[model samples]
Target: MDGTHLFELVIAMFLAIIALHYLAHRLGLPPSVALLTGGAALAFVPGLPAIEVDPELVLVIFLPPLLFDGAWSIAVDRLKRHMFGIASLAVGAVFFTTVVVAVVTHVLMPSLPWAGCAALGAIVSPPDAVSARAILERVNLPRRLQILLEGESLLNDASGLVLFRFAVAAATTGAFSATNAAGTFILLAAGGAIVGCVVGYAWVKLVRKLHDDYLMIAATTLMCWIAYLLGEQLHVSGVIATVTAGLIASWYQHTVMSAATRMRGTSFWTVLVFLMEAMVFILIGLSLRDIVERGGGFGALLETMALPALAILVTIVVARFVWIFASDVAIELAHRTGLARSVPMGTGAATVLSWAGVRGVVTLALALSLPDAFPGRDFILVIAFAVIMGTVLLQGTTLGAVISWAGLRGTEAEGAPMTMSQAEAAMAQVQFAKVKSLAFDTDGNLIHPQLLRRYEHRATAIIDYAQRTEDYVPMLHAHFDVVLEAVAVGRTELIRLRRAGQIDDETLRELERDLDLEELSAISAKA
Candidate 1:
């Protein structure tokens, strides 16, 4: 395609992305699903150029930042608190699904290489973050259930990719060694983690030295790529490296970032991640035309492989439910037997977790990476695509109803308290006490300190909220609403100041951003 055509195509794709995304929001559907469906429809349009997505390019461009953003934005404290459940779902269930699918696929197609079956299994094992996030946004799931699902989605992507790499290598070389694979897994995970931490810390130091908001944002954009590239160069797992770096960066984000950096960087990363997701998913959908032609027509291939593909998909779904519920049972048994001190998993939580296994980008990338000569490559691709579409259309669309059926719609599930992490009462009190000092200290006139001094005692509610005082929740929301109203007033005045030439655009932007942050915090707290 010529440059003009390529440019036009890009413009069209972006416009489609925006329209489909808005439509998804209106319909309470996951944007990834909407984009994929739209891309498939676009594939059949006459005169549209055929678009091919390179697997390596997809991995390099999309996985790093998306993985990084997921890691960085995740609540680290919540991750730790829900470590056992998250780890079980992310690590144990992923491997279990891989093995189950591999065994089932091999049985269903004994002619295919065992290694290729494993590769296929690894490809389709992990539920995707993009779809999961969309559902979570629309659903009012219990916080505990949300953490389990989100954390699992985040970590399992890395685990699934790592496993996929090993499986693909084994398939390519026609060799299988569990002992060697296990050792390599440890080394890759350890080495990648080390590389990522080094890169993350180095990035923090560099941005601190530069001290420019735009530069800081630019550097963060590079952080994930650097970590992944470095890890790949060292023969370690780049997926793990990117995830680790993101976590490290997140840990120091508050300390390293100025308000401007935080505001701008957040917006930049959100857009970047969303765009990459749209492109990857749509491209996968668009490639359907090529795939159909390559496979001697979709109908013929579907007729031949439909049963096996359905079986593999069922294995993937069933294996997740088996592993998670079994883990839940084992944990409950342990707690009852006095062998573990942790809270036992509730039935609702287990059921909700069991039903949320939808696959996406990692599966697409892994399937695409299969060499043309590899055994059953086309079959693997068809199966992977089928699994993605089936799961999203079935499980992703119904996750909210599942949550409702499981009765995990509140902060507590099955009478089990979802203990939220408490803010340090002292620290919160100190922060809120300075509302006047923070907002109007520069003006020397606008608002008196006494006007907002009443906010000081607001932080006292922190410990109560932490302790799950249901009655106190409304009062807290009311307080945040009042504070938000003040922020709106402050924002209007700040804009007026800029219009009247009392402040420059830069000053107005910075101050208004501070108010925006204040309003955001208030709204977030209320949520």
Candidate 2:
């Protein structure tokens, strides 16, 4: 492709993704699925040159932000509740997959050595962060199930990559030692944890010193890359480093960072991840072009498809089912014995989680990073791509059905339930505490003494609402009489305009959404 043509293709890709993403949101499907399908559709264009970006660059640059954002959003206490199942799936399942795939690959492909098989296995073992989480969240699976799946995917990607690196090193060097591998794993993991915490905490302290929202937000974006690069230079797992840093940053985020800083930082990171995800899918489509072009015929396809990829796919799926079921039983037993903190899992939730495991960009990036001169490199890449597309596109599309069939869709009570009054009071108190942190005088006294009195008044009003939850309806009627009347009048106008065709369906929807938010806030304020 020429420079102009390539630029045109890039523009077209974004336009297609944005338009299709809007459509998907309207249809209540995860927008990621639509973006993947939309990108792939562009591949059907005659003689359209494919867009090719370095997979290593994609992994190192794009992955940290996504993983970090995921960890940041995850509530520490809630994640801890599902840690048992998550550990089993993330660590235990990866080990199980490596052994299972190694055995099958060696037996089926006698020419391929154990190291080569192990490398392939490790690359395909972990589920992808982008596609899997998007589909799982859309199903609205019980909150426990959602957290367990998301947490498992987030950490397992790190663990699996760590394992993959060891296998690749062993393969390239023609040496394999379980003892050395185990020792290295421990040191690397420990080192990453230490570095991540130090870096994250240091960043927090620095942000507190500056207290500039824009600079604080910029520091977060920079932290993801810094953690990854530092971990890589130190020969530790960057994924683990990034995840740990995100967790640490989030822990201090509520207390240290200003509200404006948090808002802007969250928005920036979300948009960055969204763009990266779209580009990754488009890259996947472009990758398929290379695979097909290089293979060139039915015989090449048949050769690559022979046995190993199929075995890996089957093992991954079956292993997930077994692991989830066994872990669920153990968790239930623990809860019964008064040893567990979270609710025991149900059969339906386990089944949904098992089927929801989907491979994504991390898997693809690992494949593309394989040394071209390595023995069986072609086969390894082929199998990795096969596993990625099979799980991400096929399974992702059907995840909602699995959730529905298993009767696992709904918000499960994972955290301690908060009453309306309790939630409001807690929030109001948090705001008051943050306001008190502002420094104005030489000795860090209050910035505005009058602001303290106003905060007190606002907090008292919030406390009053909580104390009269039962009388909220009447209280709401009394507090916002004028606003409610205006909202009612505007809603009536929107309905009339829609019926008369003066405004289109889209215009009516915008008006309704704004009205809903206004009403919800008013109602919640009364409580």
Identify the candidate with maximal lDDT.
1
On residues 314-417, what C-alpha lDDT tens digit does candidate 1 reach at each position? 88888987898788788888988999977755787777778878787778878988888899998898888888888877887888788878776655423333
lDDT of 1: 0.82
Question: lDDT per residue, candidate 2, 204-254, as tens digits?
Answer: 888889857888888888898899888888888787888899999889889
Clashing pairs in 1: none
Q: Kindly give the number of clashing pairs for every candidate.
A: 0, 1
lDDT computed for candidate 2: 0.78
Cα-based TM-score, every candidate: 0.85, 0.81
Identify the runs in model 2 with alpha carbons over 4 angstroms from their true place. Answer: 1-9, 26-29, 297-308, 332-343, 412-417, 426-527
